[model samples]
Target: MPNLELLRIVDSIARDKNISRDQIYTDIEQAVASALRKHFNTEDTTEFTVAIDRQTGDISATRNGQAVPLTLLGRIAAQTAKQVLIQLLRQDERGSIYEEFKDRVGTIVTGTVARFDGPIMFVTVGRAECIMPRSEQIPGEEHQVGQRIQALVREVRDTPGGVRIILSRSHPDMVRRLFEREVPEVGEHTIELKALAREPGHRTKIAVSSIDSKVDAVGACVGVRGSRIKNIVDELGGEKIDIVRWNESSQIFISNALKPAEVAEVSLCFELGRATVVVAEDQLSLAIGKRGQNVRLAAKLTGWDIDILTPAEFKAGVDRLDQTLKSVPGVTQEMCDKIVALGLINVFDIEEVGAEPLVEEVGMDADLARRVVERCTEEAKVVAAEQEAKKAAQALAAAEAASAPPQRDARDEAVLAALGLTPGRDPLEKLAQAAGDDAGAEPAGNDETAKLPDPRQAVPGGAPETTVHKEQPVSSADTELSPEEQAVSLPDSGRKAGAAVEHTEETNADTAALAEGRAEPPASPGR
Candidate 1:
């Protein structure tokens, strides 16, 4: 028979783990039944049965409708059964924990520090215990027993100790998981994070791409108002996130990786597996970053040996390094000439050889061999970077010039000319000259070789002495009417027929008047 106290323990454990009460009851009943059947040394137990009352927590074992014999020790046996039942309940609670977190691998979960198991910290995540190693813990990060924390599930495994749920906050997936939770575009199919390079707390560069051309992957991940990424940044305690756009073209991809610094040019030597990036003098410091971090990240992101340069420095470095390699003692003019033939023309070729082999093969002393290798490697880096920078600058300059505003066209030129504008001359000069000129005498701004005015503006027969006859002068009062007004009184076509008839009648009248006036003229004089 199961003890009443044992039933209470089972009920409490079920509540703690949120396991079903029926499942706990079934497990307990089976354990007790198997123990009873084994005690009787019987394989078949049709005559025996065990039952637990739901309301009272009373257990009864019967054989053929009669109670089982209860010795003084049998009472103790019931007590022992109760203890065994409590032990089984604890195991079932742990089993429930395994079932809950087994499917959460690679996901981020929150937990509270339960205890420290030596160097490893044990955290209670939902229902199970998670183990975090000292190495996986953030450096200088402190945790109290009840302080809440978040970590990514590294592994879930079963062991003699119990369910071992390994968790880590410093893992690369921790950042990725956090980003996924905060960014819907990343969680959905719209945008994907292609690759990630991280220096944990310092900084991280995530390469992102969009499946749809219209969707901006970086903008989506950054969220509207920076709220989404701000949440992630807060969760990570302010780790810097630099989101870069991924490209199939390595030149473009590397160019983008070095952010906040503009790449002036990019030149790729595919056979050498190297890319050179040229940046403006102002941007060189930003591209190389503090201690070359920016370029280092770019190198890892693009899988290329990135060399940064400014145009002037690259040409000088390449030339200097080339000359230095040629001046090395063991490096003969014949052998030096042959080295570039083997694609080893640069000072950096010596890095490909180890110190011992360099001495044996190139026949040089150890110290000299090492020095040559070191100098060449260092020089090669500067030279390569400078070359790349120069190339990138040229390319960027070309693109900018192409996209610049277009030049003025022929129509604009004609309009300017009609407005009396001159080409390749100062407008201020023309303005100054115009202010000092006379208006009525002719526009004096025109040079002596300028053309004459149109004749339409000139009065008829009033052109210069060389072109036409001068008209007789008329008093200003009598000449008030213009030529057009004077022509108005004449017939429409000004034909001679109308003028001839009027002239004949006037002439006969004048002749008759003259004859009559001759006789009366003597008498009219005295009157």
Candidate 2:
């Protein structure tokens, strides 16, 4: 009897595994032949033929030109057939996946996070589970299981285990794909993406040009009020994107690449493949960006090494080149200007270019060109040495400043000592203790007058004993008295008797203390 059920099973498998029906039928025939060989215990060299009908899926087998029935195969033979069929089906599925994804390399695809194996994430993309390794994942981005994510198909390989599909979130093409998706003009071929540079998770700069003059490439990519770019940024976890209009001119292109910073001038050195960009002093930081990221990405996008400088620096370089060239014998001022005009800005640039350009471009004699190069070479070494020395001096000064001990004011130390606070001791605790002592001290009088203590008297063996009077408050009547009368009413009789003598003695004591490196006065005992 024709087994239409067998054909139905094959079709179902073909649909589920994305394998061709013909391939599945071929696998089944091979499996049946293996089963017959196992059932008959035939030698390895013996051949068994099997065929399956594409319409009805009836199995036919022959051995030694005789018909054989698959039903006669025992349980062991059936198990062998089942194992062989499963292996062949898995191989076919793997091949199908490899073929489908291999062509998709560099294209974007969406998938669900299936699971994680250490730093490797397995995402279910279509019927295949692709892997996104840690290196390919965007920095600071984490994916949860079952979360939908989009990535670039970086690679596809057929291995012994199965098809290995590699996905990348950090690839620069991911941004290109995003633009194509969000901007209709880009996808429709009206706008074209020229170049892109990205520091994944931080920022990206893309250069775009429009085929049609009426449509603005940058404006379209940015959409109305940045509605288009906002989508790409949101998809990249809020990464900043800069869409600049592309230009065929390298100078104009580089200026656009470093947008948000106005360029004062751009000098190109073709031989060195370097672009020296000059911005106003105020715009230097903007041109350089945080940690030179702006200029770095600009270089990558423009395919030229970039050196950002201020107006003053640019002038200095031009002047230095002019001076160095004029210093060389047989080199005239006009030749110097011509050399500077050629974008040879400094002695180093002249030295790097050697004498050929000076001869051919500047119309200088070959021997004179050699002499000019030698002069520039020697000048370059001197300039380099001077710069290195200047850098060393700056570094040394910085190190000294960082390593120097903080200067302590003598007045502050005296105040702290008077307050009974010392280094490495808690100031609050010391102040509390002093407060407690003050609270314990008995009041001298209802109205007390305070006097400044003499350092000479406070010294161990410096001057004769002088009476120290407690401070007393002056009465209202005393305030009305003249200065002479107030002096007469002063309580310190010693100050009136020998004021000059006390001043001389205090001065001597201060001089002695200062000479002994003890300029800070000791705390008075009558706190």
Candidate 3:
């Protein structure tokens, strides 16, 4: 039998290897219980402990507070079982590395390339071995054995075969971690990274802002002259870095997130998770980037669909679209095209009778269409009226320009003479007669002649001069009155006092002649 000192030495070895003494005792107890069950065909109701004496080289098995009877051969065989005990202790010491790092999934960690199993790169991260699959490694970068690399812990799983840890270097979080390590503010919570978007080994955009007013968020991440970001870039195989300022407003954030491109306008539709960004004509290429990488990353970072357009392209598109719409069925080519370009393409879409669509359609907004329709209709009316006026004016000008210096027609002399006007006399006389004016020729400064209203005033193209009333106040007021009142006022106003006295003999002679012509006044004249 082994001495008690040997047992003590074994316990010391187990303790040194971080194995507990109670664990060792428990193992032996289970072994004893198993052995007794096999040998005796009976389950023991009592528990047992393997004890050693320091003074004597004696081994004792106590059951229910008493020692068990055993031969020297059995005792010697059990005492010689130190190698078996050590084997069991070693099994207990093997802890799973996967279990240690499983909680670290979705975070960044450093690892060494352990080996490659065909396409998969086996990496050792701390206590466990994680795998960086071919899909997760940075393209064109080789992972040599024992090469140190930082990667994102993507997943962890345990199967019957063994524990598996999946890793990635292409993940956006990988870049985030690099920034956290290189920038102290990130780790200290002074600067927070709101989102990350990465094109592994190509370019990465990180949206970061500062919780502290004192800290310059982008400045700290970029370091001085971009030293900090440069370090991270070098680690990522010279991947490009874009540090965008974070904004609370998503529109502003997306605008910043799509950096390296100048944005002219950013329109956000949060309900649809979309943003339409309009850039200058020159900035289109930059906003879309080489093969649209910039906008792609911006989409991932902002979690929104980004539609990019150049101002000129958008406008031209709007124009061409409107032109096409003018050709729609049931629409005049010009009107349809105008309204379509205005963004109303369908009959139901016609917001107004003219160029505006009635409802908000895909291309046209309601209010804009309403205004456009009003403007177009109004403009069309003005244009039509102006066209008529221009034709008339041109005709009139042609007639005036074609006239032969106003030589009077000899045939019209009879009519002018009846109206007390001469053929080659004042043009006003011919015009007044042609316009059906009953009043005689206007005398210079004579209120009666000047007050003569123009008959052309009732018709278009009549004399514009007669259309304007003469300055004689009483003539206009008397003309506005009833014929009865006018008749009453005219006689008194028409005769001058001296004219009446001078014309009395002629007036009586005229009356006597009318009486002689009509009645017995002829007999009185004979007597």
Q: Which candidate is the best by TM-score?
A: 2
**Candidate 2, which segments miss by more than 4 Å at Cα?**
44-46, 403-527
Please give, for residues 60-80, the per-residue lDDT of candidate 1 as tens digits. Answer: 777678776433225445665
Task: Score residue 125 of candidate 1 by CA lDDT.
Answer: 81
**Number of the candidate with higher lDDT, 1 or 2:** 2
Q: Give lDDT tens digits, candidate 2, residues 1-527.
A: 78989988988999899999999999988888888888888855358888787887788888877888777999999999899999999999899999999999999999999999999999999899999999999999988999999999999999888899999999999999999999999999899999999999999999999999999998999999999999999999989998888999989999999999999888888877989999998999999999999999999999999999888888988888788877777888889888877878889998899988888888999899999989889989999999999999999999999998666678867877887689546567888888999999976643444544676557676565555564444674546767887776645534453665687799899999988998976689996
TM-scores for all candidates: the values are 0.55, 0.78, 0.53
Q: lDDT by residue for model 3 over 1-527, one digit each (tens)?
A: 65776568657856565556666665555555445443444556455445544444355666677766544225534543544565565555443345466778878888888999998999987656788888898888886898898888998887645577899988777887778789999999899999888888888888888989988999898889988988998888888888889999888898898887878877654434567788987888889988989999999989998988777755654454454344333334554444444433222223234432234333455554555555445544654587799999999999988984666576677777787665677758567676775465554664444354556554576554443333323565545777886775535545565666667778687788787786334367557
**Every model: Cα RMSD to truth:** 21.1, 14.9, 35.1
Candidate 1: which stretches are off by over 4 Å? 1-12, 18-23, 30-75, 116-119, 267-274, 280-282, 309-313, 316-527
Of candidates 2 and 1, the better by TM-score: 2
Between prediction 2 and prediction 3, the one with superior lDDT is: 2
Candidate 3 positional error at 511, Å: 99
Candidate 3: segments with Cα more than 4 A from true spot: 1-25, 28-60, 63-99, 106-108, 158-162, 317-527
- Relative to the true structure, candidate 2 reaches a TM of 0.78
